[model samples]
Target: MARRNDHTREELREMALASAERIIAQEGLAGLSTRKVATAIGYSVGALYTLFSNLDDLCWQLNERTLSCLMAAIKEVDETDPVACLQGCARIYQAFAEQYPERWRLLFEHRSNTDNPLPDQLSTRIGGLFEHIDGCLARLYPRIDRHERQLRSRILWSGIHGLTQLEHSNKLFLPDAMTAEDIRIHLIDSLLAGWDKESHHA
Candidate 1:
């Protein structure tokens, strides 16, 4: 029988990440540890160190992965109509947060001091999303100045992020309980209404 290389470096790295996500999902970020990840993956702590320098590094990788997935979802939105594209983007953003609460928390909720520099690939991934939004705004109102278009895009993004964060934290209060989907749709409508008013004023 051929020798079994039960643990390659790449394989171990994948296992460590999977374990980290599992731990975060089950017990929240406070419960995640290198030792726990190693144990979960049947590897020693040293093995984890060989792949990642520290828990922060591992978490950074996980956050990057989460962002990549979010970007992909945003890119998948249809762009036929500017308002529809913005609404779709907003819906996708909230859906990601609701579906992967722990991962989303790590990505956008927590403020990390670690110098987890975003890789070029990840930067490009996010830039594409912004570019699509900008394109949509430009198409909707060709007369709008470049600076105003950028401002509107930023405002929309900030609105979606704020609402998603509030909803995820369960701190959002209305007359009645609102599902994430409902909140997403409401926010999109508000954004579009503001955009329409601005367009008419211009």
Candidate 2:
């Protein structure tokens, strides 16, 4: 009976999250409220409080889940070459944004002003992606100092994130402008070129 109860609770939590995602997808973040989520999930507001302390907590939970999914997708790449791995990571990141625009927006668009730290699990999940990029840099430029490597990694992450945001938001499509794929490929090439130039100097 205890096991069954636990299972049911887990299901309810999942349902609540699903309903929240649906609401966000349909009407954006402004549409997400405790009362609306409760109504959408056919649960009382008190029931939502059982799973999440407040609507902000629910938003954080959703963002964490989205990041987890993105990290998982990136980790699935099996390329052996370091440069190829980096490119693969870029492709996967773009794919995630294109495939899950709403979730992507929640993960990157919604700025949180709170001083609250991310849960350790979510931090580790995002850290893994950075670690992977750091590993590639180590292989590409073995003589670089730790500080230099960190700087390069941050640059790479920011470049990719910016390009992904532009492409996903359809901002790349100006009058007689490039397609999303064109922008993605160009950004990836530019990043690879920059890395190659840096490695030559290093």
Candidate 3:
């Protein structure tokens, strides 16, 4: 292992995070460890602790990186129409999950230690992803209250999240006729229709 003085704290943190991501990508969360990350980055496990509070902290940072990447992917969707915006974000989300099953799964599956909740910046990045949907719903229903729009965002996100989770676990294979995209489109359309009905009644 290299001496701690060999690398600045920022460089060590970046190196550790990069190594941890690769481990999760290749071997899943079960294979990621401070020791493993340190070894891969040619540093001591102590170096990781200096940068992160604990293993959970390390995972939290890893999730932040994943969220940032996911947000970038979602942001690429065009703002043509509300339905298209929702569908485009959903499609990009599914593509990200499929492309990096382990890394994507880490965002949802890894839990931070209850004693030390995730940092504020990490929470902000996670919330930023939802903001994209919230913005779409706001445009979709210009008259809806902010709170209502927030609820709509959560509802739509839940639908897409559930679909992807099921697809990832192969539970989406019960009926062989439909592809994942087919289900995704159906979910978005159905959600929009339901919201429209509710909006009309309101």
Best by TM-score: 3
Residue lDDT tens for model 1, 9-47: 787778788889999999998898899998888777877
lDDT of 2 by residue, 1-202 (tens): 1222444777878888889989888888778888898887677788778888877678888987887787888778775888878888888988888777887888765665576676677677777878888888888779888888888888888988888887766775556765655665676568768878877886
User: lDDT at 94 for candidate 3?
Assistant: 89
Q: For model 1, what is the C-alpha lDDT against the true structure?
A: 0.79
lDDT agreement of model 2 with the native: 0.78
What lDDT does candidate 1 reach at residue 185?
74
- Candidate 3 — which residues are off by over 4 angstroms? none
Q: Model 3 over residues 97-186: C-alpha lDDT tens digits?
A: 999898888888887666786689898997898888988888889999999888888888898889999989988765667799998998
TM-score of each: 0.81, 0.83, 0.94
Off by over 4 Å in 2: 1-7, 112-115, 174-177
In candidate 1 the C-alpha lDDT for residue 156 amounts to 78
Candidate 1 backbone collisions, by pair: none
The 10-residue segment with the lowest total lDDT in model 1: 1-10
TM-score of 1: 0.81
Each prediction's whole-model lDDT (CA) = 0.79, 0.78, 0.88
